[model samples]
Every structure is written in C-alpha cells, then in structure tokens.
Target: MQAFDNNLTSVIKSLKSSYGLAFFNNLTLQLHQLINADYTFIAKIDKERYISQTISLVAKGKIGDNFEYSLNDTPCADVSDDSVCIYPERICQLYPNDQLLIDMKIEGYLGTPLHDSNGEVIGLIVALYESTIINSEKIVALFELFSGRISAEIEREDKEKKLTELNLSLEDKVNERTTELSSALDRLRFTQDKLIEQEKMASLGNLVAGVAHEINTPLGVAVLCGSNIEDALEKLNSKVKSNSLKKSELEHLISILNQSEKSLSFNLTRAANLVDNFKEMAVGINTDDLMSINVHLWLNSLIGSLRPMLHKKSITIELLVDKNPPNFITCPAKMSQVITNIISNSAAHAFEANDDISDHQVIISAKVCSDILSIKISDNGKGMTDEVKDNIFEPFYTTKRGEGGTGLGLSIVHNLIINNLSGKLEVESTVGQGTSFNLEFPSLI
Candidate 1:
C-alpha cells in the first residue's frame, strides 16, 4: 500500500510536468516498473485496420522497438473507452489465437482503454506479466487513476503534430530570410533575432536536458512534500470526524505541515534558481552591449555546457590556456554563440569518419597580444577540402542538406565575428591532418 501510494503520487506529478515525446517515453518506462510487468506499452489504436501501434514500449526491463499488432484476436480488442480487462492467469489459454501472448510466454494481462476529451476510444495501456498477476484490483485502480492524463496527453500530442507540420511552413519562410542576411548588413541585424532563436534552440537542447534532470530532484521533493501534507490533512480530518482527535495528534499534524512547508519552499526555490540560469541563456545575441569577460572563465563555462554533448560522442574538449588568462570587453552572448557554433560544428562534422577514439579531440587555446584577443579552435579529426573550407562561411552553403543540417552555424559565427565583435575569422585545413578556426577580436571593445 505504501509503495503503491508513493508510485501513484510520482506518476501524477510526472504526468503533470512532462511534455513532448519524453512524456510518453517516461510514462511507459515508469509503468513498466510500477506494475512490475515483463512488458508494458502505451499504444495508439487504428480502429479502421483493427490494429494497435505501440508508441512507447518497454520489454523485459529495457526500451523496445515500436511495432504494430492486429487486435483481431487479442485481449486488447476487448477494451473499450469505459472498459478495462485483466486476465490474472492463462491469458494465452483463453485467447488461443493471440500469437503475441504465446510467443512472449505471457500469462497475465491488464489493459485499460484510453479516451480522448470527446470520450472516443483512441488507445490503450497494457501490462503483461510472465507470472500470474496477484493484484488485478490494484492494477485496475492504478490504471483508472491515470487513464485521463494519458488520454489527454495523447490528444495533445496529436494536436501538436498538426501544429508542428503547420509551423514547418513558417520555418521555411524564416529560412528564406536567412538568405538575405549576407547581402544586407542592415538585414543581418533584423533577421538575427530569428537566427539566434533557431541556433540557440539547436545547440541548447543538451543544456536544457541537463538542467531538466537537475531540476527534477527539487521538483520531485516539492511534489513529495505536497503529497505528505495532503496525507497528514486527511488523517487529521478522519480523526476529527471520529471524535478521537487529541491535542497531541493535532500538534503532530501541525508539525508535519510545518516541515512540509519548509521542504516545499526550499526545493521549489532551488528548482526556480535552476530555471533562472536558463533565462540568462535567453538573452538575445543581437545586442551590441559589451561586457567585461575573463576569457578563460567564460570559455570554461561555455565548454562545461557543451561537455554533455561531446561526452555522448566520446569526444574530449581541452582548454589549453593558463589560469591567469586575459580579460576582454566583448558582447558575451555573441562571443558565446560564436564559440558555441564552432564547437557545435566541430562536434557534428569533424569526427564523423575517424575510427580512432583517441583522435577525437577538440583543442581550444587563446592568447592576447597587444589589443587583439586571438583564439584558436582545432579539431583532430577528418579534415575538409580547400573548396569546402572556402564556402563554409557562405550563407546556406551546407554540406549536410538531407541530414537536417542548415549550414548556417559557421555563417552565423562569421557574421558575428566580423560585423558584431569587430573581429577577423580565418579557417585552415589539410585533407588528412585536421581543421583549425582562428578568431581575432578587439580586446577592449
């Protein structure tokens, strides 16, 4: 009962807080553990074809490939918008034609139908157990508790899919504007806001994911605290109703509420502080405001954010500068975008063909001579051709068209370096050796 209550509290909180593809994925994973089932899935029904397509599936405690199955002879076919079905044992024996059950050796089955806002049966959630299910009533209660949330999210996702398709046309229009940037200096400033928005969203996904993970702890605590307060209040109410309420029990409830209040406040404040960090990232790069920046500190901070993305690819980033690095006055955000673009570009394109793990390295070294702050970002991976290097900074001149690459990263970096930061950008490459990008900007901007 205690475990189920905690799990129920967590499921409700997670369902409320999550969005996007992650929403379904997390729910399926959680349900797999929560129900202690061998296979758990959330599926979208195709009533026309009598099929169910698993959007999120977990099998044997691991993420499994999504597939479609006919509901013609399966137990899932029996579930209606208002009907839930559970077979505690010998499900395969009952449904002799259900090949999936026989193949997977599934004995127990619990399926709850999902309904949209209009109360139409759109999908279902299924939990399959290899062993006999001992708690059918509990499973039914759990499914009943979350079926609405699941249905709403599925409906929301469908709407979002439509909106995303519509938004693609707007994105195309925005991409068209990017073509005019290199031709017009005035136009560059005008369209830069949109460009920065697109670019920041691309490079910052990993950062957002990391922060989301960090924020989850505090958010979970706050949710747990709120649950505790509700339970305490329930106990107090029950005692009052029975005329068994004592002064000590009332005082204990007060103490519980006080502790919960403190925990909720502290954890929520912590989550808010983590969110505040992202607000700094939301600052527009089009601003010409120059701020004093310690070169090494700024670079380290930028690299720290990129580390997660790099580490995923088994790549290493080395900051080859001393502790007493020079301080400069440059637009920090623009500088960040510049560095971010370069690192992002290198991360995506540089190490593609290199089979050697040890060779997957990006070296960033900076030094100040006179009033010029010169920085070099070099990648020890597959180098580019002279022709490719020449046109890399050109607008919309991408080598990765079919692979979702805009070819705008280097162009943005180029424009920011020359027009925004009063800097010179240069690139050098040898086919087999490596590629190097040198950025020289004014130190006292």
Candidate 2:
C-alpha cells in the first residue's frame, strides 16, 4: 500500500502536462522491461466491458495474438470494475482457479488497477508471461508503480476530450443566436423604410390642401370682378343708346371702374403670396444661415406656412408663444422639416368622421423654461389609442391607409427632435379627445 501511494504521487505530478497518451505508452514499455514479461497490456474499462484498451507494448517472444477476455473471465476484472483502487490480492479471488490462468498461456499475472482523477478504477495496468517469475512481490510492486502513472494519463485524456466537446457546443449556440438577431434587424429596417414613405405622403397631402385654398381664393375673386365689369359696361352701353347718360352718371361710372381694377389687383397679389409661401415650404433651396434663431419665431413661421392647409380644411390653427423666445444655434431647413412633419400629421389625422373642417383645430405653442426649449402641438382630432401611441414613434406605424398616410411622419419628427436637435419628444393622448406632442430641446442647440 505504501509503495502504491508513492507511485500515485509521482504520477499525479507527471499528469500536469498535455502528454497523457504519451505517458501511458512510456509506462507500458517500462513495465515490460522491469518485470521481464513476455506480454503487457493496458486495459481501460467502461461499465461491464474491458473495451480492448491498450497502449504501445513489447512482446518478449512469440505469443498467441488473442489476449482478449470477458469481464467475467479476467483475474483483475473485479478490480477494474470497482469504483476505487484495488490491490492485486483481491483481484486473485475473482480468478481463484490457477488452471484458468494456465489455459490462457500465462504462468503469472500482475495488474495494478488504474484510477481517474476522481480515484475511480477505469481500467488496469498488467504484465503476463508463459512462466511464473521467481520474485513475485518485487515484481508486483514495480507493476503497481507503472499502473499509477498510466492512471494519471488516462484521467487527463478524458478531461481533454470533454473540454473539446464543450467548446464545440458553445460555438454552435453563438452562431444560432447571431443568425436570429441578424434576421430581426433586417425586418426592423424594412418596416422603417415603409414608414418614411408614409410620412412624405402625409406632408404632400397637407401641401395639396394648402394649394387648393390658395387657388380657390384668387380664382373666386377673378370670377366675381370679371362678371361685375361686364355688367357695368352693358349698363353704360344701354344708357348711351337711350341718351340717358348724364355727367353725374359718367363720374360715378369712372369711380366704379377704378374700384373694379383695384379689386382685381388686390386679389392677384393674394394669389401670388399663396404660391410663394407654398414654394418656400415645399421646394425652397437649403440655406447655410447659422444664426441664433428664436424658437418662437420658427414655430410661428411653421404655423404660418401650414395655415393655408389648415384654414382650407376649416381646421383653426392658434399659436401661443412666449414674449421672449429662447434663441438656439440651428439649421432652419432641418428645423422646418421637423415642424412640417408634426403639423402635417395633425392636419391629416385630427378630424374625426369627416366632420366640418372648421370644427377641427390645431394649436402650436412655444416657451423657454429652465434653459430648455419646449414646443407643444395639440390637435382636436380623433385621438390615438394607447397601443397606437406606444408605437407612433416606431418607423412605420400609422392609422392612415389609402389616403397615402406614410407612418414615417411622426418617426421623422422624433428623429429630428432627438438626433439633430439633441432633444426629446413625448406624446399624451386620449381616444375621441385629441393628441398632444411635446418636444424639448436643449437651449444650446
């Protein structure tokens, strides 16, 4: 037992290196030389089988090729099957008949049970010969030393195999998760693109409404003035033919003609103003003016730009700005885009059930408080549901379908507020009441 303990200690030290297989082979050769054995076998056992385990070896002389044995036949089978180290004496009891050994062409056998790191007997190290050795105890002790060394090597080999399997499994799981995440991102981008298109359509719809209002006013006035002038000319022609045209009537006629001319000129000017405002809002060239701009000033300007569209829909727009608007360094073109998206959204979705346009209203207000620029846009439209509100800032969420409502309007507004202006946007809404969007920007921006 003391000899076995000493051998095990040495083997444990050698097991530190990654040469478990090489160590086993070397120990097997050493045992053959030390015991002067003709045949040596290193058998690893798993469950109730020997598994035909062996390493490199030396055959002392000509021996039969077959050395295989069933778990019930071998002298050391019991020791190999145990969960702890087993001495050679206990192994002898399992193969009590010495005749059985002789039948296998072996005079004597020496086996040291091989153990794993956890000290479980996984196999055995053995030496066999055609004749019995003279010094059996000395030979048994040397065989035990070799067994201990082989046991350490086997333990290391098992751990390496397990570690390899674990690494392969981890890599497989990481790849699967990455694929799933990539697919999800692609879907999100597709949805975002769709929403952006919707936002543009909404803005276009509002522009169309403004254009109609613009054209209608001038067109209506032109028709009225043309009709009145023609009627006045006919009355004068009739008076001259009947000799009823007097000096007082002539003077009055000139005054009436002047009024008609002024009316045409005034209405034409209004029509031109409407066209210019539309052009500026829709297709104006970008400007590089970096100035300290008043938040209230831009809000008012945007509301003015959107006024014609809302007015035509009878959607009353009201503005409440602070007496002194906070100034921020900004690009007006980008700011205009943000305001346009928000106001257009309200004009498109505010009115419920095709009610009179006049009944619907949009409010634009701005104030600077606590070094923050705050702008609020509230509408008396059919308000959004909680679910709709939650996803309103998401790229493609929209309630408008066929009317060319690109869900991107609010999304763009949100991005501009946050990304460009370094700000935040929030919304509050109640179904059947209205929706209010609050935008906050750092005064510095």
Candidate 3:
C-alpha cells in the first residue's frame, strides 16, 4: 500500500501537466503497476446526456484473457457516481461467473473513479485478476488518496490553460499598437515633405516675377520706337504719291525705318529667349516619363532649363558632354528635381557679400561608359566652408535661411538621387574659390 500511494502520487502530478489520449493511456498503465495487478482500463463518460458511455480500454495487461460488458451495466459506474471503488462482489454481479468468468476460467476485479473538476466523474480506472483477490477497507482508503491527487492535477492544468490564453491576448495587443505607431510616423513625414515643396515653389515664383519685370521694360520701349518709325515711313509714301519726295528725305526715312526694325527685332528675340528660359526653370514639368533617355541629351536639357536662374547672377553656363552617353530608364521628374536643386544651391550659396555676377561661372558635364552615367556640375563662385558642405544635404541646413530658402532643395535632391534612382551624389568645396557636385546613375535599361 505504501508503494502504491507513492507511485500514484507521482503519476497524478504528471497527469496534471498533460492532456488528450496519451495522458489517459499512460495513467492506466501506472495505475495497474501501483495496484500489483494485471489488466487496466481507462474509460470516460464520452457524452454528457448519456448515462452509459462507451468503454475505451486504454491499457490492458495479462490478467483477463478477454472481457466484454454493456456500457449501461458495469460495476465501475457505482464508484464513478460517488468517487468510491467497487470490488469483487460488484464485479461478479456485472460479469457473472457462469456467463463471463467461467468462459474465461476465473475472475477478480477492482476499480476507482476518475473525476474532473466539480467532483463530476469523467472516467474510471479498473484492475483485474484471474482468481480471488480479497477486497478490504485498506484498499478503499488507498483509492481515496489517489483520487484526490488526480482532481488537484486536473484543476492545475485548467488554470495553466487560462494563463496561456491571456498571454496570447496580450501579445496581440502589443503588435497592434506598434503597427499604429508606424503608420502615424509615415503620415507625419509625408506632410512635412509637402510643406517644403510648397516653400520652394513660392521662392522660385518671386524670382521669376522680378526677372520678368526687368526684361519687359526694355522690350516695351523698343516696340514703341518701332511704331514711330512706321509712322515716318507712311509720311514718306504720301509725299512720293504727291510727286514732292526728295532723294535725301527718302534716304533718311528708309535709314530710320531700317534702324528701328533691327532694334525691335533684336530686343524681341532677346526678350523671348529670356522668357523661355524662365518658364523652363520655373515650371514644374517633366518629360521622358520612364523612357530610356539618352544621357547626353538629358544633360543638355537640364542645363538649358536652369540657364535663366544662373543668368540672373551673371553665371556663365558651359556644357561638356561626352561623345557617347549611355541610355538610361528612370523617372524624369525626379531626376530633373535633383539637377534643379543642386544648380539652385550654387545660385543661392555660391555668393558672398557684394559678390559680382561677372565672377560666377557654372560648368556641367557628363560621361558614360558601359553601364554607368556620371555627371559633374561645378561653380566658380564663392564656395562653401567645410561645415556647410558636411550638412548640405540635410533638410533645412542652409546658409541663406532669411533669403526665403526652404533648405529642403538639397535634401529632396539627395533623396531623389539615392532613394528613387539608386544613384549617389558627392560634393567638393572650398571657402573662397568654388564648389562641385558629382552624381552617378546606373544605366539600367
């Protein structure tokens, strides 16, 4: 009995931690060994409403050769109801010797109830022998002790299950919060970028308007003078029709008219060119979409677009494109933005106090070999200090802050070059002489 109690205690503790068919099967084997008996079975009340549930014999040792019984008529049912055990008498009544035992040659039996929580029996354990094994009150006491341990183990297992469910619920909540925070941050960044772009557009608009006013004044005066010359020509025609025109008078009129025409023509062409350049630089437009653009062509176009901005400060613009520029497919809008911003940076920062426009000169060039397109834009204006170059591409890091600069131009340019186009931008600068920007793009067609 001492050995039986100790092993039963251990097996109950193990059952508390496990579940399903495997737990019951092993429990039945342990119960058989504890009782020093052969043949053990574990059966459950598989349904709630049915009084008689099918028997599932989990482990069977060598005691009974074969046994059969009705689920509705078994000795184990009595113990299952009251958490007790039934012995040889009840077993004989359930399986009579003449009917069940004599055919099998002999019989003995013992069984204990297996309960779930709430003192409700879910199953029972049975042990069998081939001959008389006397039942005693000591045996009943042993069964009571084992039954209490099994109940405690089942309760502990249910608590552990609830704890596992709570942990999963808490983890899901944490993941949801992280996702929300990430989305909020992304939206905030997008709004910030929009504000910067708007600021740049405003600055460029003011510059364009000022330059247009200056050019229009000269153009308007030339047009007025041309009208006066036309009136003089009409007078000469009337005089000739009246047969009163002298050669000298005629020659003077013609000379005046010719001079006026040439002046007007030159001024108008200059004004138109200036207007075109301003429009190209000021407008937000992109061609080529995502086509494979020729690198040399793109370089020329980019310089032409920025020519007016450079001209405003008397910067001499020069292009030195390689003979063979490889074609590359990319977002033209993004590429144009990068070039415009870099060139504009020079216009904004490459000058110092009382810096003369005549001293400013900008040079742009490109070369291509195999699958690489390299471009360089340099200026001979007052260059940057080491400190400025270090943070040049940082958003809002400008020396010309109060001059209506948003400082996002270089940052946006940097982003477009690297993030959008998978390119790199490098810079070299000096305090007094000049600055240069080198950009490289892969020619991925």
How do all models score by TM-score?
0.43, 0.59, 0.52
Off by over 4 Å in 1: 1-197, 204-207, 210-283
- List where candidate 2 sits over 4 angstroms from the true fold: 1-19, 37-156, 223-260, 283-301, 304-314, 321-329, 344-351, 354-360, 366-374, 379-411, 423-445
Show the colliding residue pairs in model 2: 195-408, 198-406, 199-406, 314-357, 350-381
Question: Considering only N, C-alpha and C atoms within 3 Å, which residue pairs clash in candidate 3?
Answer: none
Across 47-164, the per-residue lDDT of candidate 1 in tens digits comes to 9888999999999888899999998888999884346898999999999999989999999999999999888999998999999999988887887777888888889989998899
Q: Candidate 3 at residue 239, lDDT?
A: 98
Each prediction's total of clashing residue pairs, residues at least 3 apart in sequence or on different chains, is 0, 5, 0
How displaced is residue 164 in candidate 1, in Å? Answer: 54
Give the least accurate 10-residue stretch of model 3, judged by summed lDDT: 58-67
Cα-lDDT of candidate 1? 0.83
* Model 1, TM vs. native: 0.43
Best by lDDT: 1
lDDT tens digits, residues 1-445, model 3? Answer: 5866687679777777666445645565566666655456655554454343323343344322223454444455565575455455445555563344345443666667767767687655566666556753554556566656545555565678788898888889888998999899899788766867685564455455545665776699688867878798888989989999999998988888888888888888777766765554444443434656666666565565466677777777788886566566666556666777777777777864467645778888877766777889998888888888898888878776787677788887787788878899899998777989999987545
The local lDDT score (0 to 100) that residue 334 gets in candidate 3 is: 63
